[model samples]
Target chain A: MSTNREIHLASRPQGWPTAENFRLVETEVPTPGAGQIVVRNRFMSVDPYMRGRMNDVKSYVPPFALDAPLDGGAIGEVVASEAEGFKPGDTVLHGLGWREYALLDARAARAVDPSLAPVSAYLSVLGMTGLTAYAGLLDVAEMKPGETVFVSGAAGAVGSMVGQIAKLRGAARVVGSAGSAAKVERLKALGFDAAFDYHDGPVYEQLKAAAPDGVDVYFDNVGSDHLEAAIGAMNLHGRAAICGMIAQYNSTEPPAAPRNLALVIGKRLTLRGFLVGDHGHLREQFVQEMAGWLRDDKISYDETVVEGIENAPQAFLGVLRGENLGKMLVRV
Target chain B: MSTNREIHLASRPQGWPTAENFRLVETEVPTPGAGQIVVRNRFMSVDPYMRGRMNDVKSYVPPFALDAPLDGGAIGEVVASEAEGFKPGDTVLHGLGWREYALLDARAARAVDPSLAPVSAYLSVLGMTGLTAYAGLLDVAEMKPGETVFVSGAAGAVGSMVGQIAKLRGAARVVGSAGSAAKVERLKALGFDAAFDYHDGPVYEQLKAAAPDGVDVYFDNVGSDHLEAAIGAMNLHGRAAICGMIAQYNSTEPPAAPRNLALVIGKRLTLRGFLVGDHGHLREQFVQEMAGWLRDDKISYDETVVEGIENAPQAFLGVLRGENLGKMLVRV
Candidate 1:
């Protein structure tokens, strides 16, 4: 039997998660069940939403169990298969991440064509991250052509795609906010009409400077001040899709910037929160459009890869701290 | 010549408004020009939205001019008409209140039948207030049958109607919060499944006790703590119609509650703000349905009438203080 290494939640964090909260455990690889496959993960995604699962509270998805491997999006090669179709060395995408080996039912894994794109792309732009940006911007916020759009966390995986999609859809102006100057420049390179670094000044002032005419659609990934700034700059009947709130995921105290929420009534704004799981209806359309964009060289994505499985916790914490320029992943 | 007594904005309020902010002026009632009519105002509405107009800041409606008559919903009889169809003794509804008489273009006034229902009914159950509740609860929130609904400011005009309509529409449970114990009791009588006085305890605690299963729709009339409470008690994919924020209308400081708005992301909640003006399309259908309810005695309405144009300011102030049981009107 081969030895497998997996990351486990040693304990829940008080506010910000630290390396001490996670443990790397060694286990013996088991034989595959009748309809299961054991995969050797190549690249595993570390996303913002995984932070929510670290808590014990009940939410849309159950909390990640303590002292158990935390599972997410992973791309791997099937090392052993008990299923009919899947064979050894076939590239597959599954929901069992944060480990060297994933033992899941064949139904839970989808075979991917590694020849068309890098196998790691299956965990980033061509998968749930890209789908989230596409669905949130078009279906959730209902962004109309020639309208102005504002997206926070503009350098992240979903945010970068949101900005690019808005431009490709004929948005008059797309404003983006990022944590660094380099990311702001990257946003501009991604075809954003205006981009700002939220660290320079107040988000409202920076956003106002970036988008003077006001924002018609806001794709919210970094909540708190970003949400407040978007609300302040929103045109009448503006819509916002609340995708993620990475800014306050580790905060112990409540945010104070959205104090002017009363303005929503006068502006007649709509703020809708959505999950990609409920948006399965848009997946087919999103995949087609996103794939076309990729083939035509109209879209580009960046990835920040960590070397070892033992660094998965650091990768996740780096995502929370806005250290990654785009999708952060752990390579096993 | 006849003298017209009208209320004028003396000065903008710093926080909470007072009688000093309004001045009663006597002016000669002018003769009607072509395509115009002079109306003898019978009853004028004093509403919460009027408070917003008193401020100097720009909003959906422009701020009231200093030392000028403040206008709102008024029911009156046409005393003189230069327009072809309108004749004397014809009752009309117009947007020129806080006055004993009004002279306006005929197109600005709608002819209303007084014999079918009391003319004051046009300002309450049969008018904009009723339509706000109808459109907000149904169209904006998209509330369905068997859903649990929670409404704040349940004793107020719009709030009262929202509770009744939800019950009539086959809601599984209806909860309401009011300012006074008597108002809470009235909500129960009005067919609310659970009613609580917001003063009794923290709104979240009270709401949780009222609807342990959680709320599907929230008609937010009070905002601030009430909005926070609704968000806390909301189930997955819950919707909130932000009709008013009376709780913070007079506050110089920002509201403290609803700090947990980040919860909207995890819970997949939708918070929408709307003005009654945009819902003109639903008016005819709403009036027909609301009128039928009234004729069948399926609905009841209450009003707190303050006599004389001089007391109109006081009546408007009373509305802000939650002093009225339902609609607060000034009989001129």
Candidate 2:
């Protein structure tokens, strides 16, 4: 047996979570039980949605228990196995994260080919993040061939993939809004027809300038002012896919509602919210299509990786502050 | 030729409109030209959507032209005809209101049989209002059987139809929010399983009590606090058909947005705005179903009729103030 280092939720956060809210703990790396396998985690994900799980409220996913090791999407190699069709040195994806090693049922881990793409991609563009973008744009927003699409948080994991998917699907115009000038430039480099820094001016004005004709689909990730801006810039019969609302996740006070929602009536708009977990049935179709796009060099992805499981909390905080350019992950 | 009395948009109102904004004028009732018909108006409809047309801003429907006769749903007897498929004394429905006479293209009028139902019924239960409820609930909201439905503006034209239709379609519970205690009782009399007077308590609390298990569908008409309350009480995968936002139509300032919109994400909710004009394709099906429902004694309707063409503006104001029991109409 060997000792493993893992991060635990030491306390509930009041506002913005800090390192003090997390604690690095040591535990014995357990042997695989019947029908179980042991995985040595290579990369663990720290997403914006995790912020919602930290709060003590009923949501789509349950809240993280106090003093328990946090769990999420992770990519790792099989160190040991006791089930059929399992072997050592196999790269796999599982839902046990923030720890160096995990003991999980063999059925819970999915095998991934390391030669096809880097192991980190399974925690990002080829994994949950990629599927979120795919299902949200194609199914939730119902993107058509000639329509224009606008995405908020355009440089982040899901947002970046959304813009690319929309463009590849024959969008007439693809626009994006990011927090910084560099991220805006990065979005343009990623094939977005127009990109704007929301801080440059009011979001609605910047969006109007970027999408002069009006947007047919809006991929909303930031919520609040971004959502309001999207509502204003959307054309008649426009659709919005509400993926996340990271802006108000940590606020102690209730966020002010978008003031222009009434425009929805005259514009005949549709806004729908979604969770990636509810769409697991799309995995096979998503993998087949996304893998082909990657091989064809039609899509690109980025990652901001932090070293060591001890730094996982900081990586999470960085994501909340919009410091990461793409997928934020922790290398254990 | 005879002198005809017609109402003109005298001036635009800044806040709530008054009788002074409308001017009754006298003009010669012109004879029908080629492919046209001259109709002596009987009953004209006054509705909430007309308030949006009073504004100069662009919307689904064009704003009423300044100092012109306002157009709306009206039923009249054809006094003269110069086109095929029509004759004198034919009762027809046309887009001409706040007037004692109308000269319009023959194609714009549809003949109705008074032997089937009253002329006013063609403007209310069997007209646009009925289709609005039918399509908004079945098509836009995608309501399912065994679901709970909550409708705002329960005593108004479209909302009353929504409640009755949901009940007849096998809704587990039909809840409604109205302005007066009498209106609440009337909603129950109309087959609403639960009804409350929003003026007696906070809308959210009242909705919580009315639907303790949460609502599956919300048909929004009154759009301020009632919309907010619906969002608060919606269950997972809930749907909202936003037909109108009468509460904010006359406000000088923008109404506050629904505060709990973030719940949409975790709940996987869908909110869609629709106009009855875009849904004219459903008219044939809706008329077939609603006519049968009415004839079979499965549905009932009410009309708050004000006398004369001069009282049209007051009746419209009364609708805005929730003074009508169901459909508000002008007997010209």
Candidate 3:
């Protein structure tokens, strides 16, 4: 195809983003230059972190430029290559998404085997989200065997993986909180010892009831009350890996919960925030162990895919609204 | 001298403790039992943490029992001893403060030398406060040479030592915040690169102006606005040692600052809370280092002394009110 369609940041949102914040544009696909590869994208990720980039604020990653195509994790087939070690017809992963075509320096893309798993898997369980859960649970929070683990947003991509990893790694009990009853059920199905719908009651009371023995490690996805609940139920010297705060991403006002932060002093707790980009050293070990878990049917994952690049904005909004389960993605 | 005047917890306060919450009691001095010693207390300590113990809440240490004498760091002369290696006239430090006389197991007391330093020094610079500053800065916060350090309550016992230690140990710059201009001046005299009176302006603005680059280590003695300010000024991977929350101790309302805690995720920061009791392993090294600093005139300390056992409760109230320049002590 000589034509390409991509989504751009039309405007910065004040709070919750809408379709008006994004613009879809059509342009001619350009030829690859020296040492560059052009890929026909298949599946692209719509992650919660993209919400932060939509705002005109500095963060770990730069804000998405206005009137420019937003980019993220994408898997596609290389249609042309001017670089060694990459060729046409090879499936590869790169950081140029929300588009039908991606042209980048060959070094930016990594070739993956289609026989090992579906290329869509590269956007979820076997990719950044999976590695995030791995490093955050084991390395960041340092979850030990026989310790109880509590996870917020337990049905979301990273949160689901964290709960399962805790159970698989010999956590005595795993408790999880989710927005809906359906998501809570999904957590239990994923082998969580206990799961609760945060909407049903106060998070502190629910978390207390769910993890009666107190949480030893907390994998935080949704902050605010979930964080306060974790702190209230955390055992002495318990730790928390602050991976994401999806609950507060669109908030124009400061979060009022986690008000019990003073408990950290008396309990001697540690709360550490981390980004997946910083944990690249664990990639090889993570992939090997994750692949083995998948091959042996020791773990499972779900995907909520929105067909067509035109719906990518909706997919991302769905993630923010908790409308999608597991990994939210857009099918190019 | 035959009778001992001790301070007892009269009642628990809902928000802030008052003189009414404490009662002075006079009782006969008891004979020492086997393995025990009776000491006539000279100097006693009144600290921020004691305020927490006044409440009937389960914390790291048990709450003070009603109508029972409060116990803490005290130095005295042994008037009677029944244990081996103990004798009359020997100076000892023990945990039986807020009283004129103390009777305790010999193991609970550590013999100290009066020639080394004033006995009251054991309650401030050469004791728990000193070790707290050492461990919280060097160990808990993992502060390294050439890093920028910011400390709240920077004129208090722990905060003053934290600033001096950071300066002596090669900190690139040290910024601190205090309640008054005098305390701010004291911090500057202690070799802080910059100091601010938190009462002058918003803590965030003052901290931003003081440490223009950013803060790498935050020794948090006062929470609320100070914690919020430090988080705002912290660089990537910055750490905070949460030692105390003197600002929030008496507040009935939840803290409204530190609302930007979500920044921890993007900034990849660590906020760790710790107690001095857990850092006993570092006491030997801390004492040696602190004693050397004192001897070489590398460090200095101040104590706000409130005379008489009858005024011990008022002294503790003064500490909570930030009336102390360094350590607040009760002289018996």
| For every candidate, C-alpha RMSD to the true structure in Å | 1.1, 1.5, 1.0
Put the candidates in DockQ order, highest first: 3, 1, 2
Report, in order, each candidate's fnat.
Answer: 0.78, 0.83, 0.84
Error of 1 at A6 (Å): 1.0
Cα lDDT, model 2, residue B119: 92
Q: What tens-digit string does per-residue lDDT give for candidate 2 at B1-332?
A: 48999899998888899989999899899799999999999999999888888989877788998888999999999999999999999999999987899999999999999889999999999999899999999999999999999999999999999999999999999999999999999999999999999889999999999999999999999888899899889999999999998888899987775878898999999999998888999999999999899889999888999999988888888999999999999999
**B1-332, model 1: which lDDT tens digit per residue?**
48988999999998999889999999999689999999999999999988888888888789999999999999999999999889999999999998888999999999999999999999999998999999999999999999999999999999999999998888999999999999998999999999999899999999999999999999999999899989988999999999999999999998887888888887889999999889999998999899889988888888999999999998988999999998999999
Among incorrect, acceptable, medium and high, the docking class of model 1 is high
The residue pairs that clash in candidate 2, if any, are none
TM-score of each: 0.99, 0.97, 0.99
Candidate 1 wrongly placed segments (more than 4 Å): none
- Candidate 3 differs from the real structure by a C-alpha RMSD in angstroms, to one decimal, of 1.0
Poorest 10 consecutive residues of model 2 chain A by lDDT?
A: A253-262
lDDT of 1 by residue, A138-193 (tens): 99899999999999999999999999999999999999999999999999999999
Worst 10 residues of 2 chain B by lDDT: B253-262
The regions of model 2 sitting more than 4 angstroms off are none
At residue B320, what lDDT does model 2 achieve?
Answer: 93
Shift of residue B283 alpha carbon in model 3, Å: 1.2
